[model samples]
Target: MRDLNVCIIAFSSTSQSVNLYKILKNKKYNVVMIQTPCTISAGCARSIELKEKDLDAVVNEIKQNNLEIKGIYRRVLNDSTRRYYYSEIDI
Candidate 1:
């Protein structure tokens, strides 16, 4: 598969992850819950994608709702292998 670099939002609890998805979806954010990729160590089996520009807003929302998140991640591509790699984001 080709490299798919993306910013993903992860949670510690599956229910909380899905709940955030519903909230973001209702707000019309380009978010989707998917099976957690092994590249990133998270607290749940499910994860969601969030836009970079929306990071601050999403963070606020998450905090306002008292949701605990594992962290954000950036999916990077290994040029030599042309495979995807995951890197943890401080935010």
Candidate 2:
């Protein structure tokens, strides 16, 4: 099966997630605010979703902005089973 080129950034605060979303959007990055996946335990229920290709740039932006993040995760979808598997990414 093919993998979806998506990554999620988990934050400990909702405000931080929204702030990052706005920052990325303003920079013309395709990002979305989504509910933090159950697999990830975070203080905030919200997270930022972006393409895997943009992961490096996003992380750099986060560093530059001094934003706090709980963790980063990459999601893999099984086409045959229609299930999603998540793996934590070490940044």
Candidate 3:
């Protein structure tokens, strides 16, 4: 499968984002998450990225766990700007 560089999993609130961030971090998904960037604003206070494959399972778990998800955005960064791609899975 093609590799996915950055995946943004956004939550509905800082508290929610924190909790999800902790859970995902502990699970160790080769992706980095940071506080919500100025470019995007929503119920989420932060965003996370994991391998494309991990997206489905993570989202499922988040749903089962009752974690609020604002949205899941897929992005590809090149020379200067970032491009957005819609995804049902993580990548």
Candidate 4:
């Protein structure tokens, strides 16, 4: 998949990432824990990555549960250059 896209989320704290990871996994959301991308300034090294199609439900659930998310990013490959399309969720 040359231009594959996926949804990514970062947290300020590892605990927060871990907690949200558990919540999403328990709910049967296809997800994987990954390192926070450098494009975003999340202090924590850990993050959650899931399929792009899961964005709406995952984002809604995160907001509803009051997860302190650093930000959300869409991993996009454009012209063979990888870039992160970000959205600030928790201010």
Tens-digit lDDT track of model 4 for 1-91 = 1424677888899999999899999999999999888777638999999887888899888888888987787665555455444554342
- List the candidate 4 regions with Cα displacement exceeding 4 Å: 1-3, 80-91
Worst 10 residues of 3 by lDDT: 82-91
Q: What is candidate 2's local distance difference test score?
A: 0.91
Off by over 4 Å in 1: 1-5
- Looking at model 3, residue 21 earns an lDDT score of 72
Leading candidate by lDDT: 2
Task: Give the per-residue lDDT digits (tens) of candidate 2, residues 1-91.
Answer: 5568899999989889988999999999999899998878746899998999999999999999999999999988879999887788999
| Tens digits of per-residue lDDT for model 3, 1-91 | 2225556777667787777777777777565777655455644567776666777778876877788877776655443435444343333
Instruction: Return whichever of 1 and 3 wins on lDDT.
Output: 1
Q: In terms of TM-score, which candidate is stronger, 2 or 3?
A: 2
TM-score top scorer: 2
Question: How are the candidates ranked when ordered by TM-score, highest leading?
Answer: 2, 1, 4, 3
What value does the lDDT take at residue 4 in candidate 3? 55
Better of 1 and 4 by TM-score: 1
How many pairs of residues collide in model 2? 0
Q: lDDT values of the candidates?
A: 0.79, 0.91, 0.66, 0.80
Q: At residue 26, give the lDDT of candidate 3.
A: 79
Local accuracy of candidate 1 as per-residue lDDT tens digits, 1-91: 3335467877788888988888888988887788888767634899998666777888888888888888888777888788877778786
